[model samples]
Structures are given as structure tokens and as C-alpha cells.
Target: MRCEEGPLSEVYDRLRAEIVDGTLAPGAALVETTLAERYGTSRTPVREALRRLQQDGLVERADRGMRVRTRSPEEILEIYEARIALEATAAAGAAQRRSDFDLVRISRAQKTMTATPASDPAAMAESNRAVHEAIWAASHNGTIVDLLTRLNNHLTRYPWTTLSMPGRWEEAIVEHAEIIDAIEKRDSDRAYELAREHMTKARELRLRIYGDDATA
Candidate 1:
């Protein structure tokens, strides 16, 4: 069946992208009328988008109405911990079961991402997500992939502009290369450890950005 991208879905996707990329800062209000006007749609679609955002944990209902959700340092750490568990397991499974076609696809995606200029944060984020999803799919575990997909949506809610910083993008490319190598070697343990370590570094970067400040 061909999935429909209705007005509501369009608004949802746009708002979600903005939220993920930090265009919509944490704690910023999402006024339905303003969004409706901006998107050239009715308030109905905007409301629907807000509802979907809430479901995705990107936005929350506040006393003044809808506001972008903010991640506390503790919460960010917890989320990364959860990611390590889920993604490490998935990477291990992928190492065990990945097909040659899967490896090729993953290699291509990573190459495209690494080739992209570091100055393009938007493109980098898109390609980074693509490579990760490809690896997740290689595992051939539907349930695990679905869970990671949902978690990733929540994870993106936090501003991760660190990837745009000097050297970090290169670091990420190298880390991805290591992950691909481990999977290609069919070393499940190594793949799992690399995945966990990669996320741990990501968590550290986020902590540096958000800091221990509770108000941040």
C-alpha cells in the first residue's frame, strides 16, 4: 500500500525535522496558529502535528500550551545508556547475520556520508541517520529495528550540534568505519563493544553541550 503524506503528516514531518535539528529550541512554544500560518495550512493540521510530536516525545503540553521538550543531563545520560543497550545488541546481531548486499549498502551509505563536507550539518545528519538505519536493518530483527527507530526519534530531540564542530565529523567517520569493519569480519563481540563505545562518546559530547546545568 502507498502511504499517504497528508497535510497533517507533512506538518508533522516538518516540525519533527525542525525539532530534531534544533531549529526549534528546547522549551520554545509551538503556537498552533503561528505554525498553521507558517506552513500555509489550517490550525487543524498544526494541531495534528503537535499531537504526533507529543507521541514522539519531541513536544509536550505545558500550561501555556505546546512546548519543545528539554532533556535534562540525567535524562540524556539515561537515554544514551538505553541506546547503548539496544544498539549494541542490534549491531552484534547484524554482525552475525548481515548479508553481502547489506554490507555493500552500508558501505555506500557511510562513504556518501563521509564524503559530504563537514560544513553541511543538515546533510551530515541525514546521511548519518541513513547509515545507522541501514546497519540496523542488516540485523534482520524487525522488533529490534522498530524499537531503535522509536528511540532514535526521541534521541534526535536533543540538540546535537557537536557533529558540526571541527574534528568530530571526522571522528564519527572513523568510528563508523570501525563499526563496518567489525560487522564485515562477523565479529559480534567487537561490533557490540564498538557500538556501545560510539554511543558513550556521543553521550559525552552531549553532556559537554548541555552541561550539568539543570536549566539548560
Candidate 2:
């Protein structure tokens, strides 16, 4: 079958989507020739895409060859801890620095997420990313924003199917609303606390759904 739009760009997008959606599970081997055939392209573009994934920490060169990076349970916990630190700091900064326009944007995104049906996991995930990215941008720290963007590449490996579980989407909406409320009030400490709490809870829920194997 022919690939979607954007030849080179589609190579990257397709591979990234597969990795993020868990089609290429963590620790799965990624043979260059197989990928090239699958995508109807030469190995050149496949190699380039793999390199980009490596730089993003989603893939790594292992003893066998290039494979999706696997995270141990301990490693997952560590990444979540780091997320707590970085996200809390970002939320604090955002609360202190966000403009009215930024607040409006965040509110709009939150509203969209809330209005989305619980059955629409893909839309929810995309909207969730947008809200978080808006907060990161409001912080006005390019360094932290860049770092978090990279970190999310790794985080995307985990299945977000948990968010679609019964009642979980509602819980997520409530959690996100609390976060937006804190940001709107400009309570930096509350905002930081809420952001950290939200991530911690998400990590726990994810672990519960997929067991230890889901982490990487």
C-alpha cells in the first residue's frame, strides 16, 4: 500500500506513531530492511528516521540492533519523579508569567477537552498534550519547554488506553480542570502541586493498566 502524504516526513511520522501507539512495542527489534519494505521506501529514509527516534530516546542501538528502548519499573518511576520536578517548576513559572491571552488559550483548550466524548481517546490525548504544551509555553522558558518536548517522546511509548477505561476520562477532565483553576487564580504553589499530583496519578493509573511491561 502507498504511504500517506509527506514522503520523508511521513516516514518519520509513521514510525513515530507506531512507536507511540505501541504497535512497535518496547524492546521490539527494528530491522532497517523490513521497515524500508513496509514503508515502500529505501533504507536511506528508514535509517534517517531511526536516527531521529534515537535522538528522541524512543529507540536505541542494542546488542541485536536498533530496538525500541525498554524501561524497567524502577526506571519508569525515576522518569515520573523527574517529570514531577520539571512540570512543577514549569507550572510555577507559568502561573507567575502567564499573560491573559495565555490564560484564555489554556481555558479554551481545557473546555475543548472537557466537551470531547469519553469514547474519543485520541482526541482527548491530543487535547491533553495541547493544554500541557500551552502551560509550558506560558512559562516563557525555551530551555524547559525543549527538554519537556524531548521527554514526552519517551513518555509517549506508554499506552494511553488507560485513559479510556471506564470513568477514567471523567477523572482526567476533573484533574485537568483543577489544574486550570489553579493557573487561572495565579496560585503558583497550588499550580505546581496540582501539576505534580496529576502526573503522579497518571503514572499510577498507567502502571495499574499495563503492569510493569508498559513503562518504557
Candidate 3:
């Protein structure tokens, strides 16, 4: 994929990254004038960036103004349902089609994830993206990969990782290994089953962690 470019693009990319990484948070007021000043630019680019973000589902119209989108538990769960469907199918395809090159990339990402402690949500989230993206790439389906990329970006806007829950890191490590093993052995059914189960577990853990925030 072509990486985004230029100053305006940089501003947009950084803002979007901060939103996902929680520097800019849900319901946080985003003033184009203020952001333009902060980024040493005019409000025009900031305005455009916010428009782009809104289109991408990271920003939303609010009574106060445009703000980072806050999602309900139901909405979040629905997003995960879509993700599970896409990724499970991708994983199944990956199992049947992954090349040695794909395995190498997947292994590296899996190792990085395992090496990170569960207490470190940031590191785990990054590695988690890598592992999942590798599987998506392995599937060799451009449309599904593009859709999943957009979905995952929106998913990361939530502030915490399911891995930070007690014992969740260990569980993820085991689960990821099983999925990778299934692909290695060309077991598409097992890969699909494992991937679907993985997403279901993630959605449950996230809802548990969100607690009152989920409902509110």
C-alpha cells in the first residue's frame, strides 16, 4: 500500500494516529483553529483533515463540535462481528494459500507480541496489528485486506487492549499460535474456527473491561 504523504497528509496522519493511540480521545473537542495553530499551519488543512477523519469514522458531529467518536457497547460489538467474519474468512484462505514468506512475516509478528508483557498495552496492540495484517496479506485478497485495514483502524480508537486483562496475554499467545499452526498445516477449517473464537473472546473481554463506559 502507498503510504500517505505531504504536510497536510502528515497532519491528518498524525491526528488520526493520536486518536487511535488515545492522545485525542472520544468526545474530546477538536477545534480546527487550535489544531492548525498547534501544527504550525492554517485552519484550512486542519478542517480538511477533520473532514477526512469524519469520513473514516474516527471523527463525528457533536453538539459541541466535531469530536472523536464514542461508541456504545452494541456498536462496538457489531464492529467486532464484522471483523470476525472478515478475518475468519481471511484466516481460512490464508491457511490454504500462505507461502513460506508469509509464514516468516507471521512468525516475526507473533514473536514480537509474545515478547511484550501483558501490562504493556501499547506494544501488544502494535504487534497484534502486525500479526493480523500478516494473516490478511497471506490471504492474497486485496478487497478483504483493505476492508479489514479500515475496520481495524476504527477498532483501535478504543483506549485499551483486551490483552491487558488478567491472563489475556497468555491466552492470546496460545490462541495466535494455534491459528498459525493451522495455517502451517494447511488446515483451513481449524484456522477459521480459531480466528472466529479469538475475535469472540476479544469482544467479550473488551466489553467486560469497558464496564459502565460500555453502556454509558
Candidate 4:
């Protein structure tokens, strides 16, 4: 959770936030000198930040310079597929290993998500991410948490949230409830199945939305 402290960290944090929030849209150019001037620092920090972002898969080398990555639908689907596998494993681990404190945190996160207004898709999406983060933490596997965090960053780059789709908010809440129930009961197998099913539904909805958007 602790990032390096310094000018480079500042630049990286600012840029990453902008990209995730869609201020720096996909395919947008990332010019080093321009960012350096904007951040009121020399190009050194900007250059290093850009390099780190590239390694994080948030930026890519463009014909002229680096730019925010623009993922194709297929690429997005692949990321979701990876998430499905990892999330299921994390859920199983949580069921077997979660402490009372961990369960409380997970329940709180889910409650926050449920309380968020469906009309506010962005807030709902953020709360939804929080729920998963708690679940991942309950798993007590740093490696899985790290990988899922990276994949989530990539997914959040998209401006839209699947939670915005009609009925999806309710559906996701129900699905999350089932997963929570399994975890609370210490049923690892059931937790794994529920988590896999949840992510699979999300992937399906995402694909359907992409197809609809393409046609639209």
C-alpha cells in the first residue's frame, strides 16, 4: 500500500488517477515535457512516472510518444477471464481462513455497496470495488491481491460501469450476498462456486454491452 515517496511518486499517482477517472482518456497522448511543465517539475520525474505507468500496463509506446492504453474488447474479455479464476480462488481461501475482523470488513463493504444509489454508477462501481478488495484481503494472499489489483486498475480505465446496466445493480448485490453467505458458513467449495458464477455473469454482461455498443 505504501508507494515510494518523492516527486516521481507524486507524478505517478496524479497521472494514474487521471487515467482511471477518464480525464486522460484511452489513446490520449502522454508527452513527457508537457507533463513535466504541468506538474511544475523537471522532465525527470515525469519520465520515470511514465516508465512506471508503462510497466503497469496503463500506458503504451505510441508512434510519437507514450499514450494511455486502449484495450480492445477481446483484451478486456481476457482480463475478465483471469479475474474469474483468481477471484474464485481468493473466495475459497477467504472461506477457509477469514478471521472475524475480516468478515466484518467484508460485510461492511458490501453494505456500503448496497447503500449506494443505483443512479450514481460511478459511486456504485467504486463501492463494488471496495467489496472485492475486502474479500481479497480476507484471503490473506498477497500475491493474489496484487495481481487482482493490477487487473482492476486496467478495468477501471473504461469510462462506463457494468453496474449501470438495467437490473445489474440488484443482481450483483444478490450474487455478492450468496458469496458472503458461503464464506460466513466456512464453505470453501460453495464460496468458490459462487465467486466463479458471479464473475462469469459480469463477463457475460460486459460482452453483451460491448456488442450492443458496437452495433449502436
- Best candidate, lDDT: 4
Model 4 lowest lDDT segment of ten? 1-10
Residue 52 lDDT in candidate 1: 84
Best by TM-score: 4
Instruction: Give the whole-model CA lDDT for all candidates, comma-separated.
Output: 0.85, 0.82, 0.87, 0.89
Q: Can you give the TM-score per candidate against the true fold? A: 0.83, 0.87, 0.88, 0.91
lDDT of 4 at 113: 95
- For candidate 1, give the lDDT of residue 21: 77
Q: Any runs in candidate 2 off by more than 4 Å, and if so which?
A: 1-7, 212-216
Worst lDDT 10-window in candidate 2: 1-10
Q: Write the per-residue lDDT of candidate 1 for residues 1-216, one digit (tens) a residue.
A: 212333777889888988877789889999987887777777887888898889888899889989999878887777788888888988899999999999999999999998898888879888888888989999999998988887877878765656875688999999999999999999999999999998788878878877634456
Q: Sort by lDDT, best first: what order?
A: 4, 3, 1, 2
Clashing pairs in 4: none
Could you give candidate 3's per-residue lDDT for residues 1-216 as a string of tens digits? 222232678789989988887788688999977887777777777888999998788999988779989867887788888999998999999998999999999999999988887767789888888899999999999999999988876776777788878788898889999999999999999999999999999989878877856557
Off by over 4 Å in 3: 1-6, 21-23, 63-65, 212-216
By TM-score, is 1 or 4 better? 4
**Candidate 2 lDDT, 129-203, residue by residue in tens:** 888888898888998898889878777776555577678888878988887778778899998999998888877
Of 1 and 2, which scores higher on lDDT? 1
State the displacement of the C-alpha of residue 7, model 2, in Å, after optimal TM-score superposition. Answer: 4.5
Which window of ten consecutive residues has the lowest lDDT sum in model 3?
A: 1-10
Please identify model 4 stretches exceeding 4 Å from their true place: 1-6
